[model samples]
Target: MKLFQKLGRMPIGLTIPAFAILLVVFGIPIVLLFLASINAPAFSATNYLGFFAQTANVRVLFQTIEVSVVATSICLIVGYPTAYLIVAASKSVRITLIALVIIPYLTSGLARTYAWIVILGDRGVINNLLLQLGVIHSPLQLIYNTMAVYIGMVHIMLPVMILPLVSAMMGIDRSLTAAARSMGARPLTAFWRVFFPLSLPGVRAGSLLVFVFCLGFYITPAALGGLRDAMLSTFIAAQVKNSFDISRIATSAFILLAIAVAVLFLLGLDLASAQGRTATTAWKSWVVRISKLDMLKRYFSRFSDSYRAKLWTTQLYQAGDDSRLSNIVGTMFVLLVMVYLHSPGLIVIIMSFSSGTFLEFPPSSISLQWYQTFFGDPSWRGAAWTSIQIGVAVAILSTIVGTLAAYGLNRTHPRLRSFLTMTILTPVTIPVIVVAIASYYGLVNLGLIGSRTGIVLAQSTGATGIVVVIVSATLANFDRTLERAAKSMRAGPLQTFWRVTLPLIRPGVIGGAVFAFLHSFDEVVITNLVSGYSIRTLPLKMWENIRNQIDPTIAAVSSLLMLVPVLWLIILYLTWWRSRLRDHRSRPELET
Candidate 1:
C-alpha cells in the first residue's frame, strides 16, 4: 500500500512506459542502423562510398534535395501572404479561413494525392474540359511528371506551412505594426520593418517542417512523378524492395537522415524556442537582434526613395478614403488559394459518384456504384478491417502512454521538460522514412515483423509523440489550482488526478486519441517498410491499386476518406465547446 502511494506521487514514473516503448521500437534500432551504415565491427564507409560512386545514386540524391527545396519554397511563397491575410481579417472571418486550410491539412495525404491524379491525368478534368471546348485536339500529357510531383507536394504541404506561420503571427501584437505606421512608415514599410522580422521564427519552422517532410515523401512523388523525377525516398524504397544489401540500404537511409539533420542544424530550429520569445530575455540578445535588423534595413534602403514615397502616398490616400479595393483584392487572393488547396479533394469527391465505368468530372449519371463496389470486394473489406484494428490499437496504446507522459512532463522542471519533450517528439519530427527504416530494423530483431502487432507498435511510436504534443498544449492552459484544491481536501495523487485533473484534460485526451487513430489509419510509408509483405492495411491496398491504376473504386475510397477530416473537425469543435461551456458554468460569478 505504501509502495503504491509512493509510486503514484512520483510524476517522472509516469513517463517510463512511453519511453520504454520508444526505446524498444525506435531508439535502439536507429543505433543499429547507424552501425550497419558504417559496416559495424569492421567499421568502414565502403557502402557509402559505393553509393556515391554510382551516377544514378548521385543524381537521385541531388534531385531529392532540389525537389524538397523547390516544394518548400513554393509553399512558403504562397503560405506567407495567405497567412497574413488570414491574420489581418476579422475574428470570425479569420476562423473560417483557418478552418478552410485545416480541412485539407487533416485530410489523408493519400486521398489528396489521388485527387491530384484524377485532375491531372491524361484524360483528367483539365484535359477533358479543354478537349470539349475545342482548345485541344487531344489529351495533353499532364500527370507523371516533375510538375505534377510539385503540384501534389505543394498541395499537401501548404497547410503545414500556413498553420505554423499563422500561429507565430497570431502571437505578435497588432499594436506593433500600428505603432510602426504611426511613425511615418507605409503599410509595406511597416510590414517589412516590424511585422516580417517578428515572423521569421515561423518562416524557419514552417520551412524546416515542409523541407524535412518532403525529403521523406514516398507516395506523392512516385504516384505523380515520372521515372526520371524520383526522389531519394523513392530510391531508398526501391533498394529495399530489389535488394537485401543491409549496408547499402542503411547507408541510403542515413544519408537522407543526415541531410535533414544538417538542414535542421543549419536553420538552428529550436522547437522549444519556436513558440515565441519572452520579454524577460537578456539585453545582449536584443542588441544582437537589433544589429541584424539594421543590416536588413540598409539592404531595403538601397531601393529607390521615389518608389517608397509613391507607395507611402498611395497607402495614405487609400487609408484616408477607406478604400475597399485593397480589401477585395486580399479577400480574392485568399479565396483563390483556398480553392487551389481544396479543388483536388472536391474533384475526387465528385468523380467518386460517376456512374460511368471510368472516372470523369461530369458524370453521365450519379450513382453509388463505386462505393458499392468498394464494399462488395472482399479484399478491400479485409484490408480496411485490418486497418481499423491497427488504428484502434494504436489509438488506445498511444493515448494511455502519451497522456501519462504529457502529465509527467507538465510537472517537470522547464529545462528538463523541454529536453524530454524534444526527445519524445523525435519520431514525428524527423523524416518518416528514417523512422520507418529504424522501426523495420527494430521489429525484425524482435521477430515481430509481418504481424499486426508490429504495425500497431510501429505506428504507436509516432502516434504517441503526436498525443504528447496535443495533450501538452492542453496542459499548458490548465489551471493547476484545481488539482491542488482537490489534494488539499485529503485527496491523494491518484484520487486528485482521477477526480480533478482528468475532467479538465478529457478533451485533449480524446483529441489525441482521434488524431492517433488518423495517424495510424493514413500512415503508408512506415506501414510499407514494417509490414514485410505479409499484411496489407487499407492504405497499402489503396497504394497498390493506385500504383497499378487497376480500379476506379479507389476514387470512392478517397472520397470517403476525405470525410474523416470533417468528422475530426466536428468532434474537436464539440469537445472544445463543451470544455468552454463547462468552464463557464463553473465560473458563473465571472460570467455574471
Candidate 2:
C-alpha cells in the first residue's frame, strides 16, 4: 500500500498501455510458439530426435552458421575501419559517413538483394558492362552461387554492423589517443595501441549484432544462392511449408533457438568482462590518488586545484563546440546517406518510368506505361490490396500486443524479466525459415493455410519482437506518475491509459507501428510459406517475378513498396521534430 502510494506520485505516459499491448501481441504468440513446438498428436521425443536424424538438416545448420560468421566477419572488417574513419573525421564528414551507412537501412532487403541479382546475373549489368568493355567475351555465372549470396548479404547487413560500431566508437575517449601521442607515440602507433584496444568492445558488439541478424536472413540467399548454398532458414522453409512436416519444423526451430541462446550468452559475458575491466581500472586510479594525497598535498594542492579548474573549463567549452559541429555534420551526412542508400530504389523508380521494355541505366524519356500497366492488372492490384490489408492489421495488432508485453515485463521486477524479454526477442534471433516452417505446419493442422488472416497472424508474430524493442525503449524513459494521478482522479486503468499515456508516447507507438508495417510489408520468407496461390502479397509477386524472369515491372513494384516505408519514416521524423519544437518552446533550457 505504501509503495502504491509512492508510485501514484510518479508520472505515467505510454508505459503501461504499451506494455499491455506487448503482452497480448508478443508474449502470447511466443508462448504459443513454444507450446506448438512441444505439442503433437502423440507425446513423443520423435520431433526432437527427427531434427538430428537427417544429415542434410545438420549440414544446413552448419552452413547457416558458416555463412553468418563469414558475412559478419566481412561486415566487421569493412564496417570497423569505416566507423573509425567517421569517428576521427570532422563533424560534417562524420555525419555524412554515418548517413551513408544508414541509407541502406531504408531500402528493402528484398529489393536490394534482387538488385544484386541484376548486377551479378549472366546478362546483367556487370556482365554486360564487362563484355562491352572487352573485359570478357563470355558472361560469367556470377548469380546463383555462394559468392552472390555473400555479396548480397554483406551489402544488406553492412549498415547493421556500422551503426553499432559507430555507437561503440562514440563512447571512446578522444583524450586517450591525445595522451598517447603526447607521450612520444606516433599517430598510427597511438591509435593502434590506445584507440584500437578501446574500440575492440565495439567491434565485438557490432560483429555479434550483425552475425545474429544474418543468421536469420532468408531472402538474399534464396534469391542469389544455388541449392548447395541453402542456409538453415531455407531448409526450415522447405521442411515446414513444402513438406508439411510439423515435427521436424518444431525440432529444427528449437535447435536454432538453443544455438542462438548459447551465442548470445557468450557475447553478454564478454561485454560484461570488458566493461568491468574498464570500470575497475578507473576505480584503481581513484584509489591510488586518494592513497598518495597526503605525501604530495602541501606542494601540489594549490597548483592542482588551479590546473583542474582550467582543464574543466576548457573541456566544457570544447565539448559544447563539438556538439554543435556534430549536429550540423550529422544532418548533412544523413542527407548524403539517404541519397546513396536510396540510389538503388531511386534507380528502380527511374526504371519504372522507362519507356523501354528492358532495364537500362537511363530511361529513354519517360512514360506512365508501367504505372498504367501495374494498376490495370487485376492480379497486381489484388496483391497490392492484400499486402496493404495484411500490413495494416499486423501493424496495429503488433503495436497493441507488443506494447502490453513491454509494460508487463518492465513494470514488475520479476526474476523472469530477462528470460521473458529474451523469449520475446526469439522471433528475431531464430531464423525466419524456422518460424515460417513451424507456423506452416501449425496453420495447416488448423486448416488456415493460404488464408490472408493466417499470413497476417504469422507476420504479426515476427513483428512483435520489433514492437517490444521500440515500446520498451519508450517506456524506459517514461515517467510513471501520470497514471497514478489519473487514477486518483477516479479514472479506471483503461481510461487512464487512453487519456494520459497514449498522447505522450504517440511517437513511439507510431514508430513501432511503422516498423511493424514495414516488417509485414517487406516480409518474404514467412509469407512464402503461409500464402496460398490466391493470396500472393506484393513481395511474393516480386519474388515470383525474380524467380521466373527479369522483368522491369518488379522494379516498378519495388519502387512503390519502398516509397511506402520511406514516406512513413519521413512522417514519423516530422512528428518527432514537431514534438521537440513544442518541447523547446515550452522549456528552452530543457531543450538545450
Candidate 3:
C-alpha cells in the first residue's frame, strides 16, 4: 500500500524520452542556428540589420505573407460552399464527394504542382488551345509569374480549408437551425446567425493553418514564380547556395519564425473556440472569457431579452432555400471547384500517355514508351528506390518516437499538457527552409550531411510532431478501465498495453505512420539541402528533370508516385472501419 501510494503521489514520467528527443534532436539545432545569426560576422547584430536594410529582401517577406493571405482567403471562399454541399447531400453523395476531396488530399503535391505548369506554361495546355483557336496571337505569359504561384498554392491548400469545415458542420446539431426557423428566422438568417457563428473556430483554425503553410511554401513558388516574384524561401535558398552566409540566412529564417510564433500565440488565445465538436468545457471557457470583457458583455446583452428578437433572412437565402435553381447552381459551382482542384493531376495522367517528346495537347499516337523508359532507365529506377527506402526508414522511426511521445504526453497532467504539447509540436510551425538550411550547416559541423542518417533525422523532426498530434487526439477520449482491470489481474504495463491499449489506438498510430511515410516521400527542400547532389529522392529527381530537361518521363514518374498514397488511403479507410467496429462492440461492454 505504501509503495503504491508513493507511486501515485509521484507523477507519471512517460514524457521523459520524448522531451529528451525534442531537446536534443530538435531544440539544440534550432538554437544553434539562431545563435549563428547573431554571432556570425564578428558577433554583432549587424547581420539582422543588413537583412532588413535591403528593400528587396523585405519586400519578399511581405509578398510571401500577402500571397499566403490571398491563397487562404480563396480557399475559404471556395471551401465553404463545397463543405456545405457535402453536408446537405444524401449519404451516398456525401461519401463520394468526401472521397473526391480526400483523393486530391492524398495525391502527391509535387505532381499536382508540376501539372499546373503543364496547364499554365507558355506551350502548356491552355495556351496551346487558345493559340490553335486563334484567340491570341502568341502564348500568354501565364507561368513564371505571381498569378501562377497563387493558383498553384490555392489548388494545394483547398482541402485543408474544406476538411475542417466538414468536420465542424457534421458535429453541429441541425436542430439549432431548425429552432431558429421555428422562431421565424429564414434559412439564410438561421445559418448566418446560428450555424456560421458556431463554425468560426473551425474557420479560424483552418485559416491559420493554411496561411502558415503557404508562408513556408518552397516548391510551388520555386517552380512557378519568376525572379521578381520570389518568396521568402527563395531568399533563404539563395543565401545558402550563393553566399555561404549563415548570419543572413538565419536572420531571414528568424523573421519567418517570429511571424509564425506571433500568429500561433495570438490564435492560441481562442484555440478551443475553433474545434468542430461542441465541447462543453470549450463553450463554458469561452463564455467566461466573453463575460470578463465589459465592452463585449455590454454589446452581447442586447440578445438577452427574448421579446426583442426578429426573424432576419437575406433575400438570396429566401429565394434559394428549397429551390431547384439553388440546387442546380450550387451543384454546378461545387463541381467546377472540384474540377479546378483536381484537373492538374488528371491532365498529367493524360499527357503521360502521349507519344510526343515535346508537350503536345493531344497525342497523334499513344504508347507506353515513357513508362518503359522510367523502368528501364537506371537513374530514374535508382532515385525511386532511394525515396522508398528513406520514406520507410523515416516512417518507422517517426512512428516509434511519435507513438511514445503521444502516449507519454496523453498520460501527463493537464496543467503541463499545453507547454509540453507546444514543445513537441514546435517543428510544425518552423519553416522547412529554415530546417533545411540549419540541417545543412549543423550536419556539416557533425559530418552527417549527405548521409542517410542526417536526412532521416531532419525529416523525422517534422514527421514525429505530426504523428504525436494524430495519436494524442485519438487518445483524448480513450477509456482507462481496461488497463486497470488488466493490472488487477497481474498483467504488467507493457503486456496490458499490447493486449488492451494498442489494439484500441492502433488506427491513429497506423494513420500517423502512413502520413509520416508520405511526408518523407513527397518532401523536397530538406532532401535537397541535406541529401546534397550525391543522393536523390523521387521528388528531387522530378524537380531536377523539370528544371533542367523538361520531359514526359517526369509525368510518368509523377503518375506512379501519386498512386502510392491512394493505396495508403485505402489502408487508412479500412483501419477506420475496424476502429469503428471495435468501438461499437465495446459500447455494451462499457455499459454493463
Write down the lDDT of every candidate, Cα atoms only.
0.90, 0.73, 0.82
Candidate 3 per-residue lDDT, tens place, 1-592, comes to 4443342334245555556655555677778878888884467888788888999988998998898889999999989888998988999999889888988887888999999989998899999999999999899999999899989999999998898888877878899999988776666988887888777777877788788888789989989999877889877887778877777788898888888778877765245643434543466568677776867866886785354453233342455546787899989998998898777887888788888776576776887888999999999999999999999999998898788778877777776777777777777766677777766776787788788888888888888888988999889978989789988999766777789889989999999999999999999988898886789888898998878878789888888877786799889999899889888998999999
lDDT of 1 at 142: 96
Clashes by residue pair, model 3: 201-274
Highest-scoring model, TM-score = 1
Candidate 1 residue pairs in clash (backbone atoms < 3 Å): none
The digit string of per-residue lDDT tens for model 2 on 1-592 reads 4443444344233244434433443445444556656764455676667666879877888998999999999888777766776787789877767655654676678888777776677877778888989999999999899999988888788888788778778888899898875555555788776777677667776777787778778778989999899977767666654675545666676677677767877766244446845844665567668886656766776677777566655664344666577667755654554453556566677767888878765676788788887888998898888888999999988888787677666665545666667666666766666666656655665677789777877787768778888878887888879788888999876676677777777788888888899889888888887786668888888888888887777777777766765577678879899888876786876666
> What is the TM-score of candidate 1?
0.93
TM-score, predicted candidate 2 vs. hidden true structure: 0.78
1 against 2, candidate with superior TM-score = 1
Q: Estimate each model's TM-score.
A: 0.93, 0.78, 0.88
| lDDT tens readout by residue for model 1, 1-592 | 4653665677777899999999999999999999999988999989999999999999999999999999999999999999999998999999999999999988999989988888998888999999999999989989899999999999999999999999989988999999988666867878876788778778888999999999999999999999999988888888888986778888999999999999988776674443434322433368668786778777788786678777767776454533487888888999999999998888888889999989988888899999999999999999999999999999999999999999999988898988888888888878898899899989999999899999999999999999999999999989999887887899988788888888989999999999999999999999998999999999999999998874889999998899998998898999889988988888987667
Q: What CA RMSD would candidate 3 show?
A: 5.2
Better of 1 and 3 by TM-score: 1
Please count the clashing residue pairs in each candidate, in the order shown: 0, 33, 1
| Candidates 2 and 3, the one with greater TM-score | 3
What is candidate 3's local distance difference test score?
0.82
